[model samples]
Target: MSFLEFSSDAFIAAFFLYCFGFLFYMIAIGGKKWSNRDPEQHVKRWGRVAYIVSTLGLVAHLAFFFTRWIGAGHIPTSNMYEFMTFLGMSIMIAFTVIYSIYRSPLLGMFALPLTIIIVAYASVFPQEVQPLIPALNSIWLKIHVTTAALGEAFFAVGFAAGLMYLLRVVDFKGKTKEARRAQRWVEFTLYVIIVVISFIITVFVFRGMGYEAEFKQMQVNIDSRGQETTTEENVQYTMPPIFKPYNSETISMDSFIGMKQPLLETPYWMDGVNAGRKLNTVVWSIIAGSLLYGLLRLVFRKPLGAVIHPAMEGIDPEDLDEISYRAIAIGFPIFTLGALIFAMIWANIAWSRFWGWDPKEVWALITWLYYSAYLHLRLSRGWQGHRSAWLAVIGFVIVMFTLIGVNLIIAGLHSYAGV
Candidate 1:
């Protein structure tokens, strides 16, 4: 088999292994209070098994990375599929390191599922290896992107820890009405995370099944004289179309259903195909995600967090909060150096400009500034516990937007990185 194919196989195997590890970690956490024999001993035994399995999964993931590198003859971070997979791997590595230091299976319980979701999301993208474009043909493509991904991965760990702290500390059983309402909101956020994972899985499954639709839209173009011209174009979008343009003509009768197209139009400069496809994919993901979430609610009869919160009883929120803060403190400088400093150097080398105000560059700066503010607020103003945890969670959201949103939503020099 070709190395790329072998790498794909290894990646799938590692995904299953990680799932098993997560299951074991959950069992470990759940057994802390319920075990008949020494609960601590029971938790320790299962935690050890979980750690070993997760470490093995990491080894397999590393093998996948090296095989892909060898097959592609370059680092595999140039496109959405490879970069997302690399981000998953970085999260796995960060979790491993942090779990070793803290010896907390609770962290793994929160983090491993996120890693799986990221890797599954990567699978939704086309995985075929393509030749690198001129802009990506520098050593900095390896150095800068890899380091930035690592830093973001650490931030992801911080998010996980911060979320755990919030869940643990939120007074779900309190007598006060505000405390109960806050608990509901925290539980609601957990349900949202489940919906997101379900959305990724639904998209992956439907796309794998060759489900697609044709979206017809009015394509506006700038003519040679800079005059606006309109043309109707049919674009194939993955997943069944829930919407169709009102003014455009449909080229394919094969679409199962249709609704009104969105109010916004694709920019004249963007290739309508790329822009339409992205919009269609996003719409279907939301539709499918809502369906899955509804199904989950019907099955469980309560928020998913309500069922899971019992196991979190043994966790110390203060400890989780401290770990979350430490993780961001360590990662912020590394992110600044890699995402900003090295990115500027690479931009100067590749594009002959150190700063172009590209969407990616701007978002990267915003991410850096957000994290800087997070640190300053925490260190100077003594923003600890709930406030610090919230900032850590929000900072990772910005990191994700910098990493994924800029490429997908904004057309810029970073367009080459899209799937």
Candidate 2:
């Protein structure tokens, strides 16, 4: 087999191993109170086994990373697929270090799933490695992207721990207004998670069905020379189109369950052919997500948070708070180095400017400022527990919008990463 094929095998191995690791962690945490086992001994044995499996999974993931890099003749983090897979691997690394320090099986129980979702999400993007453009071939691009992803991975871990804390501490059954508000927000958070996973599912499902829809959108651009250029771009959709490109002609669209045409046109405000495609993906994901959420609610007859809240028993909220805080604290400076410092240097070299008010750049700065506020509140205002957990969760959301949303919704110099 070719090196790329071998690397794909290794990637598959890592994915399965991570699944096994999560299963072992579930056993460690859930089977502790079983009828015939010693709870402490059970947790000890299974947690150790889980940690080992997860570590091995991480090793496999590293193998995948390096093999792909060696075969492709470049780091495999230049595009969404490769960068997301690397992000998943980085999250596993962060989880291992933190789990080693704390020895918390519950951390594995939650964090492994987070990593799995990420790695799985990576599969939704195109996997073919492509040569970097000359501007992106710089060493600074490598440093900036890798460090930024690693830092974001830590924030992902922090988000996981923070989510677990909320699930642990929130009084789901309480009828008081504060409790009701918390319950709604927590459910909303879980709904958002479901939406992301639903996105992955939606992509793969339509892909498996061999779905196709095509549109040609005319894009007009004016250059610094005051020269006008118009180009017709073909935009493809793997999923059924809920939204078609604005001011575009349908080239071909396969009928899906008798729906022959699109239901809506992309808003004028959301210009660009790629932006329209991305918006369709987002809308499809939310629709699928809502349907799935409704099904789950029907099955459980309770908010999803309440169902998982029981499993969080005996996991101390205070420890989770600490874990969340430490993960973010460790990530903050790394993010500053990658997303700010190195990024600016690369920007100056590439765009001939140290700063630009690009959408991606603005979001990155907003993420930094938000995290800065989180740290300030935690240290100076003595925020902890519920408030801190919420900040950690929201901060990751901001980080994600910076990383993914801007790439999808806005066209900028950074849009090449989505390729």
Candidate 3:
């Protein structure tokens, strides 16, 4: 088999392994009711298992990606599919590193499922190898794409942690009520997670399975009167004209082939021959993402907050606030350097413009500004805890728009990501 084929199998295996690991985590989280008496004991035992499964899952995930990188002769940041894959790996790496330092399994409770969703989303895109675009063929693609992906990954974890923190603080009168609130919080998080995953999947699957979209253009074709036809018309296109879904084992080339005349006039998703694979890949990813998300919710009956210790013990809530702030302090700058500065430099080199108000570019700026505002409020306005956490949550939203939302929703110059 070719390297891409082997790598494909590896990734499929990794996906299933991640699903298995997530199942174990669900078992650990759901089993909390029986362990209330000896919380630490249960935490230690199951937490160890979660850490191990997560670690192995990460290893398998990285191996699949690295094999692709080796086959492609560069880092896997050449397209939207590759970039999402990189982001997924980066999130897991950040979680593992921070987890080791803090010895906090709570982070995993929030981070691991997010990572799985991202990786699964990546699977929906075409994984086949393709040469880089003239504009994208540069060292900057590696620097810009990797930095942006890593920055988003950090913010993604931060977002989950912030949400969990808020849910934990939703005051309740008694242990019983608090426990019920905990379940509600977990359910809400699961719902949000699944929705995001589902949306991506729906977009891809709907588009890939083929949708009827009318393109308004002037075409020069034979007229009904037998003369030359040069008038603007709305053309509707469909796919899988003859082949059924069961026999449709491969991407449809002729469906969207020979469609582009002026290169820039074409939609980004239909940019090239491999574009079909890319689109199909993304759609499938969304489908898988949604399923895995639902599975996560079903398995983990307990709320994620049920698994976390107070951000600290025997200490004031104020200290927990400070620690979270300190983390953002260290992280925000790295995020700025990676998501904004490096991206600008790379975009300038590739696109030949330092700044264009393109959707992706605009979203990146929004992400940067959102975090900047967060830091400013915390330092200058004396904001802390809930306030800062809320900003952290918003910051990731902007980051998500810049990362996934930009490529999928807004049309722009950087829409090379196979939808």
How well does candidate 3 score on lDDT at residue 7?
74
Residue 133 local lDDT, model 3: 74
Deviation (Å) of 112 in candidate 2: 1.3
Assess each prediction's global lDDT (C-alpha) against the native.
Answer: 0.82, 0.91, 0.64
Q: Candidate 1, clashing residue pairs?
A: none
Candidate 3 differs from the real structure by a C-alpha RMSD in angstroms, to one decimal, of 8.8
Q: Model 1: what TM-score?
A: 0.91
lDDT digits (tens) for residues 1-419 of candidate 1: 99999898899988999999999998898876778999889888999999899889899999999999999999999999999999999999888878878888889988899898898888877899989999999999998999899889889999999988887877666769887786776776775676667768767676677765555677677989999998876777565555444345446533343433343444445454556456655666666667776787789786556656677787788889988987787778778888999999999999999999999999999999898888888889999998888788778878877877888878899978985
What stretches of model 1 exceed 4 Å from their correct place?
Answer: 175-177, 223-226, 231-233, 245-247, 253-277
> What is the Å distance of residue 161 in model 2 from its true position?
0.9
| Best candidate (score: lDDT) | 2
TM-score: which is higher, 1 or 3? 1
Q: Give the per-residue lDDT digits (tens) of candidate 3, residues 94-153.
A: 777566766655557667778878887786677777777787778877777776676666
Each prediction's TM-score against the native? Answer: 0.91, 0.95, 0.70
Give candidate 3's error at residue 377 in angstroms.
Answer: 1.5
Give the residue spans of candidate 3 off by over 4 A: 172-191, 200-327
How are the candidates ranked when ordered by TM-score, highest leading? 2, 1, 3
